[model samples]
Target: MNAEPTTPTTRATDEHLLSIDALAAWIGVSPHTVRKWVTRGPATGLVPRMLRINGQIRFRPDDVRVWLDTKEIQ
Candidate 1:
């Protein structure tokens, strides 16, 4: 399936911010798993840079990519 393009926010265009749902889709995982990474990964170091709009969390797509790239597979 083709992916939907995200409209880059002013602060994140250069950093690649994506919604949690979008990141999960890109990584082939459930959104819950993505959230787990945010809370558990020793190296994730994710902070509040993600903007919350309408009660939903927005994450940097590049951050997600970086996290996945650096994760140690068990």
Candidate 2:
């Protein structure tokens, strides 16, 4: 089985995730900007993927750190 964040095996309550607004605040950008990156749709985007907790968007802290690291190097 794929061990993706969206996997049901992983419960949202298992970890403290970052919401779109929180991520935006941390990145010094607007929540709308973060939303755009998450909705890359057909094309690849900044955030690899987002987690859905009770129909709300969430993100893993580790993933955010790695993503920021990659962007810093670029």
What TM-score fits each model?
Answer: 0.46, 0.68
lDDT of 2 at 27: 88
lDDT scores for all predictions? 0.65, 0.77
Q: Give per-residue CA lDDT, model 2, range 1-74, as digits (tens).
A: 97767547654555578999999998899999888887774146577457788999898887778777877754
Once fitted onto the true fold, the runs of candidate 1 whose alpha carbons sit more than 4 angstroms away are 1-16, 35-49, 72-74
Candidate 1: give the clashing pairs: 16-61, 17-60, 17-61, 18-61
lDDT per residue, candidate 1, 1-74, as tens digits? 75998776765355555777777788688988778765664354543235567977777666556666655587
Candidate 1, position 22, lDDT: 78
Which of the numbered candidates is closest to the native, going by highest lDDT?
2
- Please give the TM-score that candidate 2 achieves against the real structure: 0.68
